[model samples]
Target: MNPILSNLRNITLTYAIWLMIGCLLAALLVLTNISLWANALLFAVPSTLVFGSISASAYYVARSLPMKKRSFFVVAGVFGGTALIYGIIWGILCFFWNKITLLFDESWAGIEMNQHLASLLLICGTLLYLLSILVYDVLLALDNIRQAERREAASEMLARDAELQVLRTQINPHFLFNSLNSISALTTIDAAGARDMTIELAQFFRQTLALSEQQKIALSDEIALCNHFLTIEKIRFGKKLQVQMRIDPDSENCLLPPMLLQPLLENAIKHGIRDLVDGGTIELSSKVRAPWLFVAIDNPVDTQPSSAQGTGTGLKNLQARLRSLYGDKSRVEWRIAEQVFRIEITLPLERS
Candidate 1:
């Protein structure tokens, strides 16, 4: 099927152009003193419209000889042959229609059918068909470019989704191992605390499982998961670990990739608070400023050198995940100064 004929808008536009061409043809006949306005229009308008309908076949001809595969000589031969054939057909139609008008009256005839008039019609028909071929060729080229862009975009999306899945899976195992160890130790000293931690651990893992299947989760849901996580950590660390949350009401419902922040919290505990003699609080704050959501996490690290300093793999991974998800629209940065290690993230705010 012709792409132009496939849509209502395209079909309407095509006919409108052909109507203008018919009017132009009528004007030419009058200007040359070939016929009066009424007679000229009667001869040219209907014939031009019929020619225009047949000219739509130019799309199929252009498709058959695609620009990439066609040779200059072959294209010239094919186009010239079709245009000449259509031109003769159009001249015959005009000649017959002009003669038929005489059946009514001389005033009704748009033009006096003659050899000169027939030649003019043939030339015009050939040129118009060739022009149609050019237009269809350009349209097909643009359509091909658009399709290539769409395919590239889809491929990138699939690759990003695959990377996100790998990142999501990487978030758990080490934390699970540590939690199990904590629970195992607590069982010998405090049976009730161990049972409580067991329950909290179960709930945390259940929530993680639920949210992991999603592409994104609300900030509030992530906070709830973090709270469950903090509970289990508090049980293990006792009074050594403390948390301060300063979350803005507006930012709570903003959505981010699942497990995006939890790994950072795990890193803070494993490297920062656990090293301090009089363990300190981890500060987690978030605020929304119109189109942007800003979040920061700060924890106190020991001044004395320690062997537990991480190789920054988790932070690097977090950065990679941000890049994959948001491209350049999101940012992640971390610095350690004056025994305080802080990581901040900025993201485009998305809400449901």
Candidate 2:
């Protein structure tokens, strides 16, 4: 029921827009001394009836038309058929509607259609049909262009969702392996803290499991997930891993693809901080400036740590997610200098 009403509303809106266009064309009819009110009625009558039919015809044509030769045959056939069919219907309406009114309401003489004049009317109608077909073909072309654009947009969105899903899948195993290793290390001496850490780890994995299928999320919501990730990391790293945040005032209200920031943060923790004897600081910051909002994660990296792996697995997956979301509008990159590794991201600042 809701969808039917929505479709009806859309059709009414399309007709109203098409009728206004007809009214502009009707201005020419008024210049030829058709009365203003009469021109409005007659112009809209034919244009409204014919335009509605033309739109329906063009939509189906565009849907069926092959992309390879979009400019020719199929479009021509659809509009040509529309003009011929509607011109005949319009002529019949003109003929019989008057007689019906004259007989029933006893009105004055009006234009008439009968067997004697049918052939002549069809000939004239065919010429007008070709003219109308030529005019409507322009509209059909425009409709086709808009349909192509919409399909392209939908395709991009599907690709983005697929990328996000892959990123989400990678996160669980990486974090799980790390947490299990931490638990393995802690179980011998500090059994109680290890047990507590297991609880926190459970909570973190619970959140991750819940979020596995989500593609997009509110900025605040993604932050909450990040906080959970940090909570589990905190249980293991304790006072050594210092996490700081300086989020922009505007960005907390924005919507973003889910799990986008966590992978970068995890990489920072794994490679930059935890590998060192004495862990370092991780800072998250964001600020919006007109075209984009910049979010940055910075941590001091130890070059001579026990593990010296450079950029590894999650880095490429993170890049794919950013590529899918921002396409041309977003960026994520890493830089290292003076023992500090910084991950910077710029995203569209939008609200849900």
Candidate 3:
């Protein structure tokens, strides 16, 4: 569709510009003493309007030769040829239209056609057609830019989703392997404990599978999953493993990416508690402060640095996921000081 004709606003604006051009053409005739205002307007305005409507065909011509596909020489040749042809057609129409007006009073109805005036009108017509072609080319370029931006945005979204999926799969299997190994270790010494841990593990996995499919879940739901996870870990580690949560009621309904906090808990236990002869409590806390929701995990670690200390894969993956989902609006930081490994996250407060 011709852009000008596609909507009422463009069509109206195009004709309005052509009307101004028609008045300017008449003024040029009057200034040169070639025709009276009345005679010039009668000939020029309607002729200019009809030619303007015809010029809309230039959109198709410009679109046919896209900017990226055409050479400079090709554009110049095509545009020059089309403008000249349009100018010739316009001149013929003006000549016939003036002759029709001669059937009425010549003084009030028409401009006198002379060699000089005919040549001038032909040039004006050619210039107007060329201008139309240039305008359409600019519109086409803008449309292409918009389309390219949309495509790039969509591609980035797909890549982010794929990365998140891979990370989720990696994290789940890592924990599952560790859990099964713990169960296997218990089978010989205490079959009853192994059976209980296996049952708890099954329940935790069932809940995780349901929530993992969601893009976002309530903080309370995540906390509940973590509690279920802690139950399984307690059965395996016995009295050595403990958890203390101080979650603000206001922050519980806040939404976050699913499986975010639970993995941090797994890391805290595996890296921080496992090596200590007397395991320490994992402190889980959350609070809402205006625009931000803050959560932190603090656990005791062995004073001596050992190979059992984490390689930081889980923390790095958590940071990457936050960056992908929230950009600069979210932050994750971890530090080891005074034999305590603390990980904290800050996110924009979101509900439902």
Q: What residue runs in model 2 are displaced by over 4 Å at the alpha carbon?
A: 1-123, 132-149, 209-213, 305-311
Consecutive 10-residue window with the lowest summed lDDT within model 3: 303-312
Cα lDDT, all candidates: 0.89, 0.67, 0.91
The positional error of residue 100 in candidate 2, measured at the CA in angstroms, is: 14
Residue-wise C-alpha lDDT for candidate 1, range 1-352, written one tens digit per residue: 6888999999999999999999999999999888889999988899999999999999988888866778989999998899889999999888888878877876756467777778899999999999998899899999999999999999999999999877766667867887898899999998989999999999898878888888889999999988889999898788999999999999999999888788889989989888888899999999999799999999998888598668877888889888998999999988989889999999999995
Q: Best-fitting candidate, measured by lDDT?
A: 3
What's the CA RMSD of model 2 in angstroms? 7.5
What value does the lDDT take at residue 116 in candidate 1?
78
TM-scores for all predictions: 0.92, 0.64, 0.94
Can you list the residue pairs that collide in candidate 2?
Answer: none
The global Cα lDDT (0 to 1) of model 3 is 0.91
Query: Candidate 3's residue-wise lDDT over 1-352, tens digit each?
Result: 7778989999999999999999999999999999899998998899999999999998988898977789988999999889889998899989999999888975698778999988998999899999999999899888889999999999999999999998898889988998999999999998999999999999999888889988889999999999998998898888899899999999999999998988899988888898888998999999999799999999998886468657778888898889889999999988989899999999999998
Candidate 2, residues 123-181, lDDT tens digits: the string is: 44445555544444455667669988999999988877776766776776777887788
RMSD of each: 2.1, 7.5, 1.7
Candidate with the larger TM-score of 1 and 3? 3
- Evaluated at residue 7, the lDDT of candidate 1 is 94
